[model samples]
Target: MPVTTELILARHGEAHCNVAGIVGGEATCTGLTDQGHAQVRRLAVRLDQEHTTAPMSALYTSPRRRTVDTAAHLADQLNLETRVEPALRGLDHGEADGRPWTAIKRRFGGRPQQYPHRPIAAGAETWNAFISRCRAVLRRILDKHEGERVLIAAHGETIEASFALFLPLPLDDTELAGQITGHSCLTRWQRHRNTFGHDVWMLAGHNDTNHLRSPMEVIT
Candidate 1:
């Protein structure tokens, strides 16, 4: 029998760049804010209460500080070790890393008409490259962890791109760019073979923040 794989995708909590309104990539703006810590702890508490006896198979996090911090709270509660995944990191903003949004426009001749197709920074990823990385991550998870439950801590755009890999929607790059994945919110997906033996990825949850009990629950 082909078993089902459950994928839990959690967005990292708020970070310095979120408050500063600047672009981020690499190790820039890595630490989670105080509220971010609270958010992740709330999520951990919820998971602890619900899954005290059942620990997930693996915990993977983006190699950035914010995501690492967020994953730590959950991993500690569940007694699981974490692995850093570069494919799970956020989009690289390149030249826009430290510039304010307004300054970014002035410097880059205006924010690329579409973040997916345009690079706000000369060294940043094109939308296609971003999706490709997301696909790679998904493929790895499917191939390696079938029938298991796995948790991932990643970025907003990364989550959106991952969704794009499996969702059969009319969402354009504009729609994908417009999504706001709240801090510490959790999204879930399941993978199983269909009646035709075709592999399918189905969404089970999206942006679930009910675990949050603080102002951090406010979607940014």
Candidate 2:
């Protein structure tokens, strides 16, 4: 027997800071830009069509403004309530919470590996901490919502962390640097009964962005 669940992970729309190349960590409260809003609207419309009657049972969102807004719109479309999960928040950047990427690259280009663990300027959290929290949160969500389909609205870092967990990779700065993207991904997990009386969770789909590139127009 196979116990399966579908997890839809969506990156929040482009924030004003994103367009400006700002490093928006957990502390940053930047909302979505106009284009970002349009993208979310398009996503909602598409979701509505796919799930006109059979929709996700619940919706989860990070505490950030952009995620909250995106979740709100999605909740309206699905007729579901939105729940906030602080653990789903973006990586905390301590002192460099809102600095531009260019500035960080300029200041620490030679030592990129050390940047994630460094204090970031004042008292920001390290990349290691961010990965740990995100992994824990995702695990909790999976356990709590077993066998149900869920939609999560979160930041780029949050999505990356979730992917890394299912894929089992070391969360290094170089790895994180290459994971950020605009499209959404679908990850499905299935629980199977083994001959030895053990249950295993297997990956069904990983990093799928088919919906974004379909013939339908995805504003993002």
lDDT of each: 0.75, 0.71
lDDT tens digits by residue: candidate 2, 73-138 = 788767889999988987666667778877875775532335555545557666677777899999
TM-score of candidate 1 to 2 decimals? 0.84
Clash pairs for candidate 2: 94-124
Instruction: Please write out the lDDT profile of model 1 over residues 66-128, one tens digit for every residue.
Output: 888889888887788999987787777676676677787676565443545667677877666
Task: Count backbone overlaps in model 1.
Answer: 0
